[model samples]
Target: MVSTTFEDLNNSKKKLITDALLNEFSHHTLSTAQVSRIVKESGIARGAFYKYFDNLTDAYNYLYHFALQDIHQTITTDYHKKFQPDDYVDQVREFTEKSTNSRYFELVKMHLLFNEAHFSTPVSNHLIIENEFYWATQVLIHDAIKQLMLDPSSKELILQKLANVLHRLAKEDD
Candidate 1:
């Protein structure tokens, strides 16, 4: 995601730095993520990372925003028009189907599979905070309701269950 943004960054060095940041952030949470690994993986000096971004958290935040922007453009703008909360189910099903075979879907699945426990921990501790996830999920459910693909009440129930499951996944101590 961030890679495309930095693809024509007009600065080759900066592009490499951004790619490395994105890779590391995707693989690890902010707490357990390491800057040295990114530096090594990016083939840049350790100091180069600091030069491009303020710190690991800053880089993560930036990449986070970048990924969300892409997700929004891909799902909302590409296939749908207005956001009708009632049509959420159809939207979710449609988008899910499309994304099911896409690299994006696979990436999301990988994140969910690997980071379940990490995310659940923060959620349990009231520390899991990211608008991207919330917005993405909301969009999914909202569309489902708007499309009448799923019962409104059922959609709400599933969303609630998702929140709890996410929390447990993140907080489960290994």
Candidate 2:
């Protein structure tokens, strides 16, 4: 968690630090990121960096959640409602397109490629409900995203496979 001191910063100052963290994480894995670089880029003192975050991992978590919130807002599907395989595929496709073009592209790519498994807080498995089908679909969706990050040209094929599996799961549940 970030310090209250960081939360107290004005929006513009927060954005500056956010941008710097994004740039640093986009270019380097968490293992290689440098506080000095972030401080220099954000125009904050090294001491202020520590004051704002407990450590580099805290800063990275902050940036990760920040990007996630922005991306989630762009997705229109309500997963809490009925799970529509086609609709989910469409949503994933839209997300892939937007994320590829967004400012956080490299950061997301870097995370999927290298840093994701190393996160201090492992990715959540919590779902809206506790059905095994829902859990499987969620895992598959995440895998599809990772696959898209690795080979963007395979998107149509990947989405098709994902849709096929999801439809099969839905049918089985009936």
Candidate 3:
């Protein structure tokens, strides 16, 4: 989350900073990114950047959450609703199809595979095990999609294999 100073910025100013951050992170992974570059590109002073976020990780998390918000809006997932394996697969498939169309999809996948320190830790108050199961499945889907991207020729075969594996996994819940 951005600091109150950032949230309070006028819409145009906010949009400028957001666009600059998105472009910066889109082109470079966290380990290779530089705040000085972002500040120079955004035409803002280094102090302004710090005023909005604690550090690069904080800025990255804010942008990452922004991407997730877009994804959730594109595909509705009710956390409170009962879980069904088939429905879960369908939702993942839908997200996979739609998400690939976005410009930030590549960056999002890179963040997933490369950023080990940022995984969400589920709260323990309710359905903690269920949350872990879903999180694991999400990770599997990300890895499968990334693999498919790397070998476009094997996409159909790999997708079929994944479906078969998921089918077997779903049956275990019976």
TM-score computed on alpha carbons, candidate 3: 0.79
State the lDDT of candidate 1 residue by residue for 6-125, as single tens digits.
Answer: 444567766677567667765666777898999998887777566666776667666654544555454553222433333444445445455444334433443444533443332334
What lDDT does candidate 1 reach at residue 48?
A: 57
By TM-score: ranked, best first: 2, 3, 1
Clashing pairs in 2: none
Between candidates 1 and 3, the one scoring higher on lDDT is 3
Model 3 spans with C-alpha error above 4 angstroms: 78-83, 123-128, 131-139, 148-155
Q: What is the lDDT of residue 135 in candidate 2?
A: 78
Q: Give the number of the best model, judged by TM-score.
A: 2
lDDT of each: 0.52, 0.88, 0.71
State the displacement of the C-alpha of residue 27, model 1, in Å, after optimal TM-score superposition: 1.9
Q: Give per-model TM-scores.
A: 0.48, 0.90, 0.79
Candidate 1 TM-score to native: 0.48
